[model samples]
Target: MSRYVLERVQLSAQNHPKRHAAVSCAIGGLLVAATSALSVIQRSETVSWPAVIAVAVIGGGAWAAAMAVFVVRLQRRMKPLPPETDPARVRAARRLMRNGELGPDPETNALAVRMAEQLQSIPRWKKFTTTAFLCTTILGVLVTAPAISDGEVGKSVFYGACTLFPLLMLTVGRARLDRHHRNAAEIRRAAEHRTNTEAER
Candidate 1:
């Protein structure tokens, strides 16, 4: 039973890369929104707090709503287990999936488990990086606000970098993940084709 469930988990992880990232994106979006709101509070003397909060709420809510739509679409697009797949495995997979534990586990093959662990760690690492980024951004803004009053151009440039670097890093990371998934898909297709040709021969 566990074996079958693990197999299904592995299948989903390999086939549904986009779905795995959905929750992560939601987390990041919320984090960014919170930080932006905090930044507003920090600059309340210079900025209109009520107006900034209104914009943040509207923008963040819209972004979150859009992401929710994307997640629903991705879920619908996920391919079900093939007709030839074992009924018991399918049932177990569906149960575990409903509970949201569809990643590889200790019972899975060691090599595959290691790979899954590595992939799973990425989100954890991202969470840590997001926290660090938030702290850095906040600190930069605080430092720069004081310097801006003193007319320090160097501090202003650093503040701009602090704001943009985290976003740039996230974009690059997402691009890399997309490329990795594309390559994985190509390899899977080629392997399937080769196996089918050999079986026909």
Candidate 2:
């Protein structure tokens, strides 16, 4: 049973890859690199404004560019072109869905419901991961707060944005959790309806 549960979890994750987690890790890596580079630059005897701006802009631009490319690639993977490649097929699919005939067959729907139930572990894990990240961010900020000059409001604001980024990410994951649960419930209901209808026949 445990093996089945694990298999279902793996399958579900494969179907809906957690690109957000990858992006978050990328951002975290960039942040750490930037912080290290800043420390190295500041250790020099002469830290000119041009040098500071150059480092900041280069680091930030690289991070932004990486994120943009990642998003584009992820969007392509999430929404493939097969369905849209043929207009006739696309129209037919839309019509079936509209007429409530596009859903998975009975056996598939039952399997999906079971898979979804096992997949509940995903959202719970997400919640726990989010909470852990939040606590770590808070602690990190507190430990590093003294390093920044009190009058450097811009730097403080940047730090705040960095902290909030993870929170925003986890919030979206939580939303996906709710969506997953709703979809699972709908599949279960559909499967039960089918079972009853067949029995009555």
lDDT of each residue in 1-201, candidate 1, tens digit only: 364665555456445646644655567667657756765665555777687777677666667667766555544444433434553544543343333333343222222223323333332355677677777667767767886787867656656676667656666765666554444344344445655887999
Worst 10 residues of 2 by lDDT: 79-88
What TM-scores do the predictions have? 0.42, 0.42
Tens digits of lDDT, candidate 2, 1-201: 342443333333344445543555467657765774675464454888677666766776676566656544544344232321333333333333223332544333434545444444333555577777788678658734754656556555666666666666667766766676666555556667877898999
Q: Candidate 1: which stretches are off by over 4 Å?
A: 1-29, 46-49, 80-171
| lDDT score, candidate 1, position 116 | 29
Q: How accurate is candidate 1 locally (lDDT)?
A: 0.54
List of clashing residue pairs for candidate 2: none
**Residue 125 Cα positional deviation in candidate 1, in Å, after optimal superposition:** 26
lDDT of prediction 2: 0.54
